[model samples]
Target: MRPKIENITDLRGEISRLRVQRLEQEVELTKVTARLKARLHFPVLVYTKISDFFIELFGDDPEDLNKKKENKDWVTNILRVGLPLALNRFLFPRSGFLMKSVVAMVSQKAAKNVNKDSITGIIDKVTDWIKSSKEKSRKEPRMADYGIPPDSETY
Candidate 1:
């Protein structure tokens, strides 16, 4: 009877150990899944890619056309801010006027806030909104309300 009781105790300990191991494995799996999702859903790489495109298009070289400083600033800002904003609107259509109003208020607040950190946060939010919008847009096909442009071939 003593030996039998010892054996049962050992079996119960093993079962408990196995349960702990399984829980650890499950936690690790969750971490891995979360990391992968962060990689896919975040737009840090997308922002860099867009920035590079704009730089390549507008950055000056000795052999390139002489560009004005003000023009360059305008182009840079447009690409940095306007492109993402427009893309967001095109892709994720909330109420057009509502979006406009919110963006306008955010912009005004950012400009007036005068705090670097606040502005940075605001900009980040704007970029995220744009990225999400574009992702939504890419999933849908455009309607053919307007005729295709001349000098262009449709595939």
Candidate 2:
């Protein structure tokens, strides 16, 4: 007989693993945040207007940028966790890929939980992650040295 993939215990196990793993990724997240905070210069400690980053990074359309700016919370929350998770995925391809998968599963359920209070919580979490990550890296590095800037041939 074939094994079933729908075990409740397995799902819970995966979620617990993801939460712990996400916490661990907090270290690299700090590095990325320090780079961004230094380069972008957003007035708020947290990078609240994340669409600007996307536009600067990708050369997105002006109308799309404005729309994204209007729906800023959605952008902030998505980028808050998604950016570091993405960078980690790029740097260490074998890591916590399953957490991204799990987030996909729970995200719809999580949408209802996205209230004003929850947005505040997301902002706090992202800001804290950046601050903690920056503290860990004693000295800050330049973005140009990393080749992630305006006139770079590589992305």
Candidate 3:
């Protein structure tokens, strides 16, 4: 004959453990849902579209530009340096409401630092810096001095 159990303690302990596991799973699920929602948000889509537009507008065909040679032109310069700086300025400001919404949804701390005035100031500074850098480069000797073919002849 087998001995019978008297107390319900074992069953109660198992129930509590299962409840804890379920709560953890729910918390994890909520986090994943929030991240997915943020990723699919409309502002992100708009931002991506704007970036694509700028790239298409300013960039040349990659196949035409030889990477081994230091080739610089106004269009290439604008596409490489100006576009990214402009996009960063455009996307992280309080004026960038959609971007702020996405950032806030993802991480509260990051959203705190994203505001309009500061981003505008930074944009101005970067613009000035790019202008100065371009001017400085123009003052330097030609690629012929460094043994690279002139950019025009290559293309």
Candidate 4:
């Protein structure tokens, strides 16, 4: 390894250099340890792992999500992601964290039932109802003078 120590002065120099090298290595070790400690910090790490577990548990497969994107099955994804969020924000706005979490879990499960076809059917029905309402509100033909008296701006 190191060249053979010759004189006393050289030995002293080598010892000083070795000590400096050891201190440098120790400093590097502390830096690495700090980085590891930050990464392993309890609350953040646990929260991340728990959230990941819940996501996987709740039928969120990475490949499936990608496939859904390719298929443009946005309705299912939106329902899954948004329904729980909407419920938590609106239905349980003032509820405690536990109740909100329960609502979110339940709504996430229920959202599975609302696929594109179901949402599209509901949308079609709503549009049809709106169209029918508009048709029903159409002005009616009647006796001309009586209708003018009712609709016209006059004394």
Best by lDDT: 4
Residue pairs that clash (backbone atoms under 3 angstroms), model 2? 30-133
Q: Model 3 — which ten-residue stretch has the worst lDDT?
A: 68-77
- Judged by lDDT relative to the true structure, which candidate is superior, 3 or 4? 4
Q: How far is candidate 1 from the true structure (C-alpha RMSD, Å)?
A: 24.7
Question: For model 2, how does the per-residue alpha-carbon lDDT over 30-131 read when each residue is reduced to its tens digit?
Answer: 989999888777556344566467567888889985775565466456655665556556754665767655654455335434546666888999999999
Where model 1 places Cα greater than 4 Å from the true spot, the runs are 1-19, 22-35, 38-44, 55-94, 97-113, 116-155
Q: Could you tell me how far off, in angstroms, the CA of residue 45 lies in candidate 3 after the best superposition?
A: 0.4
Q: Write the per-residue lDDT of candidate 4 for residues 1-155, one digit (tens) a residue.
A: 98689899999999999999999999999999999889879878898899889778887888886775575466777877898888888877889989988887788767766777887899999999999999999988866564455656755
lDDT of 4: 0.83
Model 4 steric clash pairs? none
The TM-score, computed over Cα atoms with residue i paired to residue i, of candidate 4 is 0.43
- Rank the models by lDDT, top first: 4, 2, 1, 3
TM-score ranking from best to worst? Answer: 4, 3, 1, 2
TM for every model, in the order presented, reads: 0.26, 0.20, 0.27, 0.43
**What local distance difference test score does each model get?**
0.65, 0.67, 0.63, 0.83
